[model samples]
Target: MGRKKIELKKIECPKEKSSKYSKRKKGLLKKAEEMAVLCDSDIILLVFSPTSKPNLFYPHSRPLGRILERLSNMSEYEREERRSYTKKV
Candidate 1:
């Protein structure tokens, strides 16, 4: 038999929700680190839980400020070129 599918809704049980969050958050950060290393690229992930707690993940070599600065310095033309190239591939 196939695995059961869960309904797309908020988990009502506090214990179940916390357990799910802990497991999934770890998985998400691990994948981000793997991708950054494998692709030789910068990656940042920011997540907020229902109670306003924040989580952040990024490549160890670069700081979040540097990434934000790099993005902020891009010109409109450069951004457009990048977007076009991504669409073509």
Candidate 2:
């Protein structure tokens, strides 16, 4: 069976909101790891918690510093062009 669909609305209860966020964050991290592995693609995912703590994920085989350096060397236009190319593919 496919995954259940969650309603796209704010959870009104603070307890529920915190619980849901914890669950979803872990799920997202797992998916990011899988995508990096199965696709043999570079991925950099950075998420900030409600309290502003950062969580970073990238393939352990490739260093995050190298990816950041490569990304920094690209111009703004180049970044957008690459995004469009990937979207099309």
Candidate 3:
């Protein structure tokens, strides 16, 4: 048995939109946590709802900004080069 499929478009009803967002957000965070634990990774996940509510998850040992700062160290050109290389493979 498989789950029912829903269209990829935006949900038209406000209540349904909010409900779906809440469910998906929790699921995403849960998966990220599982990945971090199983892989022994440092993860930082952040989600902002359409209503501007912020939800975040990260390793307890480090501040979130430090992880973001590591990403910032890569120049835009360097990032683009890596992206293009991956596409070729």
Q: What's the CA error at residue 55 for candidate 2, in Å?
A: 1.3
Q: Which regions of candidate 1 fall more than 4 Å away from where they truly are?
A: 1-7, 76-89
Q: RMSD to the native, candidate 3? A: 3.0
Worst 10 residues of 1 by lDDT: 49-58
Off by over 4 Å in 3: 61-66, 72-78, 81-89
If scored against the real structure, what TM-score would every candidate get? 0.72, 0.78, 0.68
* lDDT (0 to 1) per candidate: 0.88, 0.89, 0.85
Which should have the higher TM-score, number 2 or number 3? Answer: 2
- Tens digits of per-residue lDDT, candidate 3, 1-89, equal 99999769988898999999999988898888788778977788878987898888886766778878877898999989988999999
Error of 3 at 4 (Å): 3.4
In every candidate, how many clashes are there? 0, 0, 0
Residue 60 accuracy (lDDT) in model 2: 94
RMSD of 2: 2.5
RMSD of each: 3.7, 2.5, 3.0
Q: Which candidate, 1 or 3, has the higher TM-score?
A: 1
